[model samples]
Target chain A: MPDSNTNVIEIRNLTKSYGKNRGVIDVSLEIKEGDIFGFIGPNGAGKSTTIRSMLGFLKIDSGSISILGMDSVKDHTEILKHVGYMPSEAWFYGDMRVSEVIKYAADVRGLDCSEEARKLCERLKVDTHKKIKELSLGNRKKVSIVCAMQHKPKLFIFDEPTGGLDPLMQKRFFELINEYVAEGATCLLSTHVLSEVNKYCKNAAIMREGRLTMLDSPKIDDETFLSFYDDEG
Target chain B: MKTILTKELKLNLKNFLIWSLVVGGMGFVCILLYQSMETEMADMADAFSNMGAFSDAFGMSTLSIASLKGFFATEVGTVHGLGSAMFASILAIGILSKEEEQHSAEFLLSLPVSRKKVITAKGLCVLIMLVAFTAICTLLYCLAFLIMGEGIEASLFIAYMLRVLLMNIEIAGICFSVSAFSGKNRMGTGIGIALMFYVFDLMGRVVPDLKDYLFIGPFSFANASEIMSEIEPKDSSFIVGIILTVLGVATAYWIYDKRDISS
Candidate 1:
């Protein structure tokens, strides 16, 4: 772990609930600058809930979340300016062309991402001229990836970013993320795929049923981790 | 906000155009029919004057069917008012919920903009579209009167149109507030609210005792036929409408800011 002073994200007793069921319960974790933190969880494991609360997308029941030393709820707009987010499902205005969607995203962030977007599109083999509705799921994911990374934000929050990509594309996605981390950027990658986490992450947090069950290193073998997960179940 | 507004306007351009054309076309056809029926309107008015229950039920009690404005108010205006209310409610309901329904809320809320800014921008877009639809319909009304070799008093025309516009805005405000509170069921909730208000208005007209409580429905305050015939609008209903609108929009902003976005 990095020093406490360099913590990019600090969560203290974060709690959220949907009706009577708990969405997240007293979940707290810290990530320092430049750390590749993996948030591993199965479906309904509260991974998305935690990330969304951090991003100010969902109103939490109680506790605090600070990003880049700024209160997540009070300074959400300012905090988001320095962060890049890619959601699991890539959905956009179906009527717009891929290029228009990217341009709109860039415009919203007040950035000129044309060049970077073009390069990413070329690398990912995405067709910019095609309408978003016509693109395959994998291609739409590529568009979302380009939109997220084009701005080169200080922090990246990716939720199941490689769900629709092929093996080759997934490799390239990891390469892009690794390069970003090498530039002293922090990443919070939420996914259930343990192989990718083993290959890319230095630290990992596993969640189960709205609780953080394990927070450790990915140095443990896949079989051992799966066995531990099974024993918990 | 500008980015979101532009995208929203572009997405709903087709919808706005369709609603405007439908209302305008109906008005135009009614005006043309009025030109041919002008000779018989005196007799028609005499016949309708005795049907108190029917006239009150349809809000044709005060309008003189012999005049072009009165006839338009009684027939075309009533239909257009209902249509406008439905259209405005749908627009308000769809503004925010479409993102969630399409599974695009995650991508949108993740942007650098605040939730307040997003909702404000969406509200602005809906307002602009409603104003555009009203303008188009007003221009068509003017053109239709001109073609029939008749003209409406400028002040009267403005007053009538303003009443319609205000009613639409009030309906939109209530529906938008409901939409903000609802999740995926926003459209249904909005429609239900609109239907409830309309039913209340109709019941108030049919029952004498409930007439005093007409302030509860937006339709009671801005009846086109009443406005066209009267010199001044009823102040109590006007004040009630303004209050409802302000309360609705303010409540929407408050709830949307605090609500959890589960999708």
Candidate 2:
């Protein structure tokens, strides 16, 4: 990890739940600028919940999240201005063309991201003319990538971004991410993929049952992390 | 906010057109049939007047069904009232809930726009839709009158349509509030809210004991025959209904701001 004390994201005792369902509990995390921090966990291990709670999509029951040194709740919109978030699933309006969806994303940010979006779409071979419903899962992920990265935000949060991508596309996705990270940006990559964390992330946090069980470096092996979840009911 | 508003308008345009056509087209057809049913309605009007609660419930007692205006009020009135209410409710209910239903809430909320701005944008979409629906249906009704060579009271017709618009806004606001609280499309709940309010008005008119409390429901202000006879019918229901509409929208903004969007 690059030596940087400037925290891009800081979470302290974040707690969120959906009615009777279990959500992240007392989760705390911090990542400095220019760090590719991996958030690894099995399905339903609160990885998404933590990321979403940090993004202010879900109201936290307790604790606080500071993004780019701004409160996630109070300054949610301001935080979003400089952040690019790619959710675990990429589902858009079915009736809209891929081009329209990208336009909509760009329009919301009030930016003409056409140049970046065009290059990304060309690189990913995205059929901008096709309706979103007609696109494959991999293509949808590509569209998500374009929407997220076109603006070139200072911070990037990708949740299970490569699940539906082909091996080549997945490699490309990481490559593009590396280029951005090289530009003094910070990233929080959440996924269940151990290889991605090992090969790409500088550091990681293993979450289990709504809590961060451990925070370690690239040397943290998959066998130990996988065993932690396999041992539980 | 402008971006989302335009997007919502574009997305919801198809459904709006469909609803406007179905409801207004039905009303237009009803007006066309009035001339053919003239003799039948004249006989039925006298018989209906003696039917007590049934006639009163439908406002056939106060307004004679012998004339086109009266017939339109008694027949097409019910159709438009029910149809427009359903349309408005459905539009409002789906405004926010569909984002969650399609699992696009994360994509939408991830933007720099705040929850309040999202609600406001969607609320404005609902308002613009309600207005367009009213204008389209009103134009169709006017066209029908012109086609039939019938002379409808312009002031009374305007008043009736305005009440219907107000009623639609009330229903839409309440359903929009439900939309904010819901994680997915609550079509049934939205329809039920509209139907419940209507049943209350119908029962209030039929049951003498409930008549005084008629102002509690939106239909009380929108009874076509009431507007037909007394163009400026004294009903405090619109005030109550409008206030509730404001409260409903406010509640939507409040709840959506705090509610946890499920993954």
Instruction: Compute DockQ for each candidate against the true complex.
Output: 0.78, 0.87
Candidate 2 C-alpha lDDT tens digits along B7-113: 99999999999999999999999999998999998888899877889888887888889888888898889999999999989999989989999988999999899
Query: Docking category for candidate 1?
Result: medium
Candidate 1 chain B: worst-modelled 10 consecutive residues by lDDT = B225-234
For model 2, state the Cα shift of residue B158 in Å. Answer: 0.4
Residue-level lDDT of model 2, residues A1-233, one tens digit each, is 43478999899998888788888889988899999988887788899898888888888899989999999988999999899999988988999899999999989999999999999888887899999999888899999999899898889999999988999999988988898899877899998788898899988888888988556475567677677578462
Best candidate (score: DockQ): 2
- Which pairs of residues collide in candidate 2? none
Task: Tell me, by lDDT, which candidate is best.
Answer: 2
Instruction: Return the TM-scores of chain A for each candidate in numbered order.
Output: 0.94, 0.95
